[model samples]
Target: MSEIGIRTSGLSPYVALPAELESLENLGISEYQRAAKITDRMRPGIDIPILGLFGEVGSLLAALKKQTRDHPDREKYAASIKEELGDTLWYLANIASRTDQDLDVLAQRTVRSISDWDEVQPNFGTFDDIQSNIKELTQSEFEAILITLAGRVGDLVKDLGSGALTNNRDRLSGHLVDIFGNLLTAADAARISLGEAATANLLKVFSRWPLTEEYPPLIDDGMPDNEQIPRKFEILIEERKINGKIYVQQKLNGVIIGDRLTDNKREKDDFRFHDVFHMSYAVFLGWSPVLRNLLHLKRKSDPIIDENEDGARALLIEEGVSTFIFQRAIDRDFFKGQTQVDYDLLKSIRDFTRGFEVDRCALWQWEKAILEACRIFSELKRYRKGYIAADLISHTLEFRRVPEDRRED
Candidate 1:
């Protein structure tokens, strides 16, 4: 059958070849021979501690880092890094495959053994215990172990401290796989004991905590009668005030929307102005407390907002606008659809304002709204440059038109 026409019946369409076939075919005999030759070239200097390993692996790490950092051309650097990584992996696989081993099987076995070991031994207990274990391994045994590990899994370890230790990808890969394999096993056992202590403490707190009335009033006694209190405080006192006095002043503060004023219609205007002003004060005063409580609650509750909103919103808006423009350009065949936004670029916008504020949820909400607006504008193609410009001008005019009394409130 022709290669294009050949199709197996009753087999998974996706399962054409074993997943390992690519690695095997790519490296195969010729690549293995090349690696063996390289290994032999470095063998003469094997007795020299740093020279043997450094020449073989350290140079590769340094070159990779430099290619990644020094190049202004991102595409070039990315391609170089990818190619180097492939070469490194090919070399590793060749070493393993020729040495009568399967890298995947080795990885699985090592991980399982480490997991079991950790379960049986429990804790390392102290730093001294860890040191003693490290000291116990013989030099030849350590070298053999590292070599075996590197041949199976060297890509996991990160380089550290001036290319002395982790620069040897071959050796580091082996040592890391071994160390982590064992470490994970130990962690599993340790977590069980640690988890018990944590649960007990949580239960103790839950049992002793008191329940209180909801929507309690804020005390107005704290405010001076003649002195003009901030709008936020005033709103908080009005909204949270129960009976003749404020009972829940601290809980009521929030942000003021100075732009959201009512039309001058005596009763409606007075009510709207007072309500918004009081709410704003309440929101401001309660801001920190609410944020603090939200954080505490978040530890036990599901985190709805994971990052800051304002910055994220701006980034999202920027991204949406950029994406819209790019798509339009593409549709118009401006750049022949060559320009593409990468996954990283999109994620960068999404996570732009992470860790900026305490109430990440609030920020996320605002950002989400901005992103939505951008998406709508992009899809509709109604709000192009002209619309954006006009909106900005109108917003400015509206702000400037606000009366001084309303602005003060």
Candidate 2:
């Protein structure tokens, strides 16, 4: 229970949180203010919406600070803060409407995101409750969800480029800004004030990877290709029959690490995905699980790559990051005859990323990783102008040497 009449569940703070949704709707701005011609003096359509959205955010923060610190009356301060928040929502709703974006989509996506932590949600109430639920919410799960979200964001960008919604116009920003309403509701459901979430994220980053006087390059400008990836890993195709139906999967070094299928040795295109991307990405982020759990399904034991419940999470994230490269290859018609295994991976990633409410502390890290990943992809595009695809993958994976020090195992 929160002071704002918002209710949270063990499943997620935002999952179907009606009170938060209703509160956001109630925070409507006056039609008179929306029609004001003051912004018409400037950039008109572009400047007004953008400024209105951010300006209201600023105002909301200011009011919150005053309410928490300067105001003497607690009840009055709470009421004032709620009104300020409503003002912010009014601007966000206007932004969504201007861009023809769907608030329902936004709400659903936000709800799903936070729900990823459903396993831990039932065990605790506050952020401090996280410490006790650390085992259930391990680093593997965190990394998995992070990768999945990153991939979804990438796919969204690709869609935007393909003129899926707003075309190639600046309305793209408007579409992106539409998620703010759901995000606010998510914050409420997660039991953390938006201000606290932002501040905590900032402090977490500053405490760990502090800013340096001279920042390092995105990818190290190094010497030789021989040192890029230290060793090679095998990608083996295996087949199994489940209830009279045969299914194929991709295995890395004898382990059924992925769910992709490669038909036969003659199918050269089946080997399109480079294990280097998945392996190096996991190791670099220290999301690799220490123990491999073998589950008994029938006669032969099946190796579950996901170390625990959370390891399944890391796998999903890995798939998202890996999917961008794979999807790009397919889009470019690089692999003409590859066996179609799981086309729904992107859809899954998108559905989850959109619905999942980001964690209070990890949100900042996820954003940083996503931006850096975009830059990496851009660099890869420039370097692979004429080179072989393998070289491109190798060079890209070279950016982060496997962080052996951080490896859980």
TM-score of each: 0.21, 0.26
Give per-residue CA lDDT, model 2, range 144-165, as digits (tens).
4323333433444455456564
Q: Summarize candidate 1's per-residue lDDT along 1-409 as a digit string, tens digits.
A: 1111111232101112122223222233233333333223233321232223323344334544575467446555434333333333334334444443443433343435544633322211321122112333443443344344344333332333245343354554454345334332322222222122222222221111211111111212133432212222212111122454321111222543223323234432112212221122123211121222322222212232313222344335433434443344334433332323333333343344334331122222222223333332332222111111111111110001223243221
Cα distance off (Å), candidate 1, residue 285? 20
Against the true structure, candidate 2 reaches a TM-score of 0.26
lDDT agreement with native, every candidate: 0.29, 0.35
RMSD for each of the candidates: 22.7, 20.7
Candidate 1 TM-score, C-alpha based: 0.21
What's the number of clashes in each of the models? 26, 14
Please list the residue runs of candidate 1 whose C-alpha ends up more than 4 Å from where it truly belongs after superposition: 1-343, 346-355, 362-371, 383-409
